[model samples]
Target: MNGRNPILAEAPTEPMTGISLLGTTALLFEAPGETSLAVQRRIWSLAREAETWPEVREAVPGVNNLLVTWREPPRRLAAIVERLAAAWETASPLALEGRTVELPVVYGGEGGLHMADVVAHTGLSPEAIAEIHAAPVYPVYALGSHPGYCYLGGMDPRIATPRRKVPVLRIPGGAVSIGGAQTGVSASPGPSGWNTIGSTDMIFFDAARTPPALLQPGDSIRFRIAGVVR
Candidate 1:
């Protein structure tokens, strides 16, 4: 992943670069290079605008791309693509006032199963690691990996660690882990390759809630050390 920090929105100056078909019904719109929040916001804006069109069924935004599925097979794919291109051209910069969620974490103990591994790789003391990791107010790039899970960006590079060679069979929900240049919180108990540094009590998903996901793209997160969990 590039060193670019994720943000909610930035000035829309970049142009729409490329488009590709996914299977038969989905169109993947691509921006230039490694995904950034600017590209993400643009994709999100375009996806939202595309929702108004009759041809669109769903518009899923990724890091640097937007996957749009058609409501029905169009008579001419070329024409639909052309319209989408037009929408992309005129789409405004995203202006969402997303919420900032504060998650209290218990770092460096049983909850942080891979804390020692991270210390070895980064050569940073456990306390230093906790300080650096908790410093940044990470941005939600997208929701993937699991239900209500968040792919956050803006982790301090000093604490960056690679994913495990062999994934753990089961990591409990609320596990705060770092994989490659990105970091995220697992929403449910599942297999993972990311190195767990801590855990939070935040409920990421609830079926009974109006919005099942506790976090959404464009939201911000600030992690605070809430004592150690032995």
Candidate 2:
């Protein structure tokens, strides 16, 4: 919610900053807390600048932070931060541009093994739940936790349910799941606490393919129920 946008008009009376050990380099940024939004905005602003800088190798945006990875042309964190701050001061945010994709899923019964649990928690029928989930197009957030993992946002509050009590160890690939207010597609067989409401046949990441991950940040995804749960 806070990464690219800052809620406060000005920096708080006391601002915090720090460094994180990532790989062989250190990432500097404002510490996480109530001011996370402000920090994230600064990070985005800096990342936008770093994008133009030759020293920075990669600038990855996250839920509330921007990761600047550098290589070869060595530079200090302070100098990078200064450059990023200047960039944030001058550059206007680019328009939100991404593709919209519709995904077909099978919900309920066996397909949505967690439907009963969801109904018990939200007091909604399986049909109602399906309708609510399929109502809106979810925005792709950050892709992580697993390769090709599509981190999505924007779900009907009615269908926003908690994760499973215990995660299944080996959820087959293409598993469509919901947790809290987000939905995602599992790109590989792995364990997760998210509620598995459906499954997709789409291959998210393939080694043999030119590009691996099917979903990217800022992309929009829609859900369409194609079959019954059983």
Candidate 3:
């Protein structure tokens, strides 16, 4: 195991280009190679290109994957799949220079209900954990889980912690959390399997506003240490 900490996120069991059916409504394309920003950019590139296809209703990006939804499964599915593989070969990283928003976080006390759990797992002090978590300018990889929520990338690996065994019934909005190799702040929470270590007061979604989500893929979040709980 190279004597590395076992808390690290596991490697992908499936590799190379893979296509699967998410029911019959959509086809999911999982990109091969390491899960890095470059790969993510390639997924972004694929999404942009795939969206223009007459068959595609929408091309949604995920962490190292793309979901292309359609009104109905195309009749020439095999040909479409072949074309998708061909498209992936030529797809290149699309640099999306987006807005950067800094969020002030409170890294313990009530906000961090699971702070002790993370401390137990990672063997890092809360302060150290906060510092490591705050170190990176995380990119909004994609949005999922709930409305206006974002899936972020670029967390430091030292503090990697597995998702909770059992999800909490509900976590407060603005919860800054970690689940395995990634982390993000919850915009509006319901249930989450991630470890909550901190929180912010940012209102990420407002239905009354146009383009309700505060951040999109390619946007950035720099977490500022507003306060740390001892």
Candidate 4:
């Protein structure tokens, strides 16, 4: 561990916080701060670069930071850390080719089991909430937590809110939700802390599908409310 926050030293240009984990075979960089659109995009870009390194096993990015796993032994751990640090110093734009996907959501009522909560927080009725969520096109920033899971941006601030105090244990596949300033679709059944406002029929991830995740980093997503479910 550097004893200093990596995000503070590395990403000083942005209001991002970071932490470093010391290990024999790998070093981890964690950026802890307010989750915003720009911060999440930058973090994903960093992960894309880290993926090119032969020694790197996988670069898993979250809302604000990255967890870089390496394939080398503990002795090479320091060297890998130095490489990652230097990359941040001269970070360049990622060349990842992304695609766009349209997701249909059935917001409010039965489709959105927690639409009432959104109404409570924003004082927007279920109908208005659906309009707001579908108003803007969102950009996929990262895939996280679980496979085919996406972190998105471009949500209307009116609907932005904190995650649920108690997370749902298992949301059905294709659940659409908002957390912080972003909105996303659940590719598989999993626990989520975000506010569930609706669901989509679009399959985000499928093991049987040739390219599992329906959306990738940099893809655009627009939601279409299926209809009110009685």
Against the reference, the lDDT scores of all candidates come to 0.82, 0.68, 0.87, 0.73
lDDT of 1 by residue, 1-230 (tens): 56432221221234235877665677788766676677677777998888888878998877777788987655567667778888877776685568999999989798899999999999988888888999999888778767899878788888889999999999999999988788888999999999999999899999999799998888999999987543
Q: Which residue runs of candidate 1 sit more than 4 Å off their true CA positions?
A: 1-18, 228-230
TM values, all candidates: 0.86, 0.77, 0.90, 0.80
Clashing pairs in 1: none
Checking candidate 4 for backbone clashes, the offending pairs are: 24-74
Tens-digit lDDT string for candidate 3 (123-212): 999999999999899998888878889888899988889999999999999999999998988999688999999999999999988898
**Candidate 4 on 174-196: residue-level lDDT in tens?**
88888777778888887888888
Q: Report the alpha-carbon TM-score of model 3 versus the true structure.
A: 0.90
Model 2, global lDDT: 0.68
lDDT of 2 by residue, 1-230 (tens): 45432212222334335434354343544334533324444545556667777777788766555676776423344455555545655645443467888888888766567778778888988788888888888776567788788766667777788887888787878787788766778888888898888887878887777777777766778888877564
Candidate order (TM-score): 3, 1, 4, 2
- Stretches of candidate 4 off by over 4 Å are 1-17, 31-41, 95-97
